[model samples]
Target: MRESASWLAPGRVNLIGEHTDYNDGFVLPLAIEFGCRATVSPGPEGMLRFTSAQEPDPVEVPVADLAPGAVPGWAAYPAGVLWALGVDLPGLTVAVDSDVPLGAGLSSSAALTCSVGGAANDLLELGLSPRELVAATRKAENDFVGAPTGGMDQLASMLGEAGSVLFCDMRTLDVRPVPFGLDAEGLALLVVDSRAPHRHADGEYAARRRSCEQAASTLGLRALRDVVDLDEALAKLAAEPDGEVLVKRARHIVTENARVTDVVALLDAGKVREIGPALTASHASMRDDFEITVPEVDVLVEALLAAGAYGARMTGGGFGGCVIALLDQNAVDDAARAAVAAATAHGFATPRTFTTSPAAGAHSVGAHHAG
Candidate 1:
C-alpha cells in the first residue's frame, strides 16, 4: 500500500538585521527561487527511512530513536523534524531533492525541515497553522538537529510571499509584510556563495548567544530587543570591567534591530537606493562590533560594492557563508564577476553567484491517494 505526498520549501536570504534573532530582535528576509522538495509515503507506524539526492546512503531509524546526535550529517535535519513533530509511525519513507546549495548560508536546512514538516502536516492531517509550523520546524532545528538558530529561516520559508520581504518580530513571532519590487525597479539581489562553512551547533554560535543573554541579564532587560536607549545602554554595559566584548555584541543587536525597521520603511517607500548605506553599516557593525564577518565575507562585500552595487552585506550566520548585494539589474553580472575575481585573488574559492527574486512560501505540489 502506498499513500504518497510531496511538499516544497524555499531557501531564504536575509537582507539586513543579522545575528539578532536569539536576542529577540527583528529580521528582514525573503524566500528565494531555490528550494527543497520532499516526497513522502506511508509505511509502518514506528519505522522511518530517509534518502536525499545529495546523500549516498539512506538513513533508517525508528521515530523513538531520534535524539540529539542520534543522527549525523544532513540526515539529522529531517530526522530532527520528525523527532520534534513527535511522529511515531509504523513505517514511513521520504526522498528529498534540493536546489538550495548546502553551506551557502541560504537556509537549506530550514528548507528541508519545512518541506518535510509541511508535507507531514498534510499527509498526517495535523492541521497546524503556518505560525505553528514555523515553531515546530524551528524546534526541530534547535533541539533535535542541535542548531541554535532562531525562527527567521523557518518563518521565511513557511510564510514568505512572492515579491515581499517578511518583517518578523522574534519576541512576539508577529509578522508584517513589506513589498519587494526590486526587480521591477531595475534592481537585482545577488547572492554570492563565498563557500565558507560554519556550524551553528558549535562553540562560536553558542558563545555569541551566551554573550547576548549575559548582556540582557546584566542590563535588567528581557532581551536586546527591549533596549530602548542605545547610547545609555552601551554606556552602562561599557562601564563593567569584563563587558567590552559584551558591549560590542549588544550594540550590534541594538542598532541592527533599528536598521531592519529603517530598511523596511525605505523599501516600502520605493526608496530602495537609499537602503544601501544601511546595508553597509550593518556589515561594518557585524565586522567591527559583533565580530562575525570573516575576511572572505568582507572581501565579498567590498567586491560587490566596488562593482557598483548599491549595498552589500554578509547574509547568514556569521563565521563564514554567503553575502547578499543590491545592484542595478544591469550590473549584476559584472558585480558577480568582480566578487569571484576578488575571492580568487585572495586565495579563496572562485565563488558561486546568482540573482534571486522573492518566491512563494512552502506548499504542497503533489499527492497520491492513500492505498
Candidate 2:
C-alpha cells in the first residue's frame, strides 16, 4: 500500500432546483472553489483515527467498531465511509482540513465524506468508479449519518467541471455539464452566508420528504417526476382531507423541476440574464410551498432583489442557510451591502458574502511516503 495520500473535494451550490432530487427530479448545481481535503496515512493496527481542523477533538475507533451511529459528530462522516466500503484493510489515520464553511448551505458534509472516500480508494487501490464512490459517500450520509439527502451533492462533487453547472437526472443517474460563464457576460454569482445555523439532519427535512412520498403514492406514480399534468394532480390532491398541505408540497416539486429545465435552457441559449425570474420563483416556492426558508434567508433574498439582482434564492436543505444571487458583476458589492443591512435590521446575525465560479471536482492533490 502507498504510505500516504491526500484528496480534495469541493462544496456545491444549487443554482435552481431544491427538494427535487429526492423525488427523482432534476437539479442544477455547480461546485464551488472552497472545499475539504483528507490526508490518509498509516495508523496503529486494527484501529482507525480521524481528525479535523474544524473540530476540537480527534476520534479513534476500532475497525470492527465502525458502524452506523457508532461514531458521532463530524468524525462520523469520514468513519462512515470506511464502514460503507465494507472492506478489510490496515489501520489508518485520516487528517482533514477545509475552508468550506459549515452550516452555510454549501455541501460541507459531502465534501468531507468524498475527500475521505477518494483518499481511501487511492490508498487501497480500490479501483472504484466515480459512480460507485458517489454511492459509497452518499450511503455514508444517508444510512450512516442519518441525513435523508439525495445523491445530488455527492454527484456534483464527483463529476463537476470548471466553468460549468451539472444537470443531474436523479432518476437515471445521468449528468451533463452546462457552461456557466457569468463573467464573460459581465455577470456575477454571489453567495451570502446568513449564518443562521443550518441543520438538516432533523425531523423537518425528513418531514418534507415524507410528504412528497405520500403525495406520489396518492397519485399511484413511481415518483413526483412522473407527474406530467400538474393541474390534474393538484386537483386530485386538493380533494382529500389535509390535501391542501400535500398540494402545496407537490406543486413545489413539479414547478421546481420545470424551473431547473428552464434555467438549463436559458444557459444553453446563452441568455443567462433571463434565468433571474426562475430563480426568484424558486425561492418563492420554497418559502410558500416547501416551507423551508427561514426568515433571515427570506430577508436576504428580498434585499438582493430590491438591490437590482437579476435573481436570488435560498440554496441548500434550507431551515437556514445561504442565499445565491445572480446580478451584474459590478453590482456585487452594493447588493451584498444591501442584503447584510436588510438582514441585520431584522435583528439577524450579519451575513458573510462572496463571489464564486464553477470549479473542478474531487481529485488527488498529492501523495507522500515516510522517510
Candidate 3:
C-alpha cells in the first residue's frame, strides 16, 4: 500500500483562441509554471480530510457522504474529483498548496482538481490514462462545481510539455505539442493579471455558450466549427430575429478557429513574432463580437501594444481576467510598467504582471510505500 504521494498540475494561458472551445473549434494554450500540488495519504476510517495552505481551516467529510453540493467552496474541487471517480476506497487525507492565482482566468480550478485527481490515481494504483484523468477532472468542475466550461483547460494541464504549446482540436480531442522557443527568439509571453474577478459559473459565460448553441442549431450543424463558409453562414443568420448578435458570435468562433490554424502554421514555420497580429485580432473579436472583455482588460491590451508588445489579447473565459502579451524579452519590464500605469490611470485596480514560458504537465512529484 502507498503511505503517501504528491502530484502537481499547472495553470494555462490561451495564446489565441477564445470562446471557441465549446463550439468545437480549435485553441492554442500553454501550461504555465505556476500551479497546484496535492499530497495524499490514508486517513481515519470512513472519513475524507482536506487541508490547504491557502485556507486556514481544514475540512473533513465522510467517504460515503461525498456528493455535489455536499462540499462547498475551495474544498469542493477535490471532493468533486472523488465523487466523479466513483471508486471504492479507504478514507484519505489530502493536503494542497498552490501558487496559481484564483480568478485570474488561468485555470486555477482545473489545476487544483487535476492535482488531487492525479495524486489519487497514483496513490491508489489506479491505471487511468491522461485522457481519462482529463475527463474525470472536467466532470468534477462541470457536474460538481457547476461551472460551464469546455475541456481545454483540463486537457492543457494534463498534456502540456516543457517548451511547447498545446494545439487542441476540441471536436476530435486531438492534441499536438508545438514548439514555442520564445527565449531563443529573444521574446517573452507577459501575463498581466487585471485583478478583475472573472467567474465561469456566471450568467455571462453561460449566455455566450447558449448563443453559440442556438446559432449551431439554427444552422443545422453540430457546432460552430462546422461552418464551412463564414460569409454564407452569417448571411443566413442575419435573416432571423436577433440575427445580428448571432452573426457576431458565429463570426468570432469561425474566425478564431482560422486564427488558431494560422498561429500554428506560423509557429511551425518558426515565424514566432508574426503571430502577434493574430493575438491582437483575437482580442478585438472577443471585445467587439463576443463582448467578453472588460474596460480594465481592454485597456491593458492596448497599453501592452503601445509599449511595444508584438501582440496582446485577453485570455481565458473573460468577463474580466488576465491579458497575455507577446514581445521582446528586453521590453518586458517596460511593457509591464506601461500596462500597470494604464490601468491605474483609468481608475481600475492595479494589475499584476509576470512572464513565463511553456511548462510540463501534471505528474507525480513524490511518493512513499507502506512497509
TM-score: model 2 vs. ground truth: 0.98
Q: In candidate 2, residue 112 scores what lDDT?
A: 93
lDDT (0 to 1) per candidate: 0.88, 0.93, 0.93
Candidates 2 and 3 compared: the better one by TM-score is: 3
Query: Which residue runs does candidate 3 get wrong by more than 4 Å?
Result: 199-201
Residues 123-212, model 3: lDDT tens digits: 988898999999999999999988877999999999999999999999899999999999999999999999986644388888899999
Error of 2 at 341 (Å): 0.8
Deviating ranges (above 4 Å) for candidate 1: 199-201
Q: Per-residue lDDT of 1-371 in model 2, one digit per residue for the tens?
A: 78888999999999988999999999999999999999988899999999999888899999888889899788989998888887996899999999998888799998999999999998888999989999999999999988887999999998899999999999999999999998899999999999997655378888999999999999999999999899999999998787989999999999999999999999999999999999999999999999999899999999999999999999998889899999999999999999999988999999999999999999999887656
Question: Per-residue lDDT for 3-55 in model 1, tens only?
Answer: 78789999999989898888889999999999999988886678789999988
Superior candidate under TM-score, 1 versus 3: 3
Flag clash pairs in model 3: none
Q: Under the 3 Å rule for N, CA and C atoms, how many clashes does model 3 have? A: 0
Instruction: Give the CA lDDT, 0 to 100, for residue 86 in model 2.
Output: 79
Worst 10 residues of 2 by lDDT: 197-206
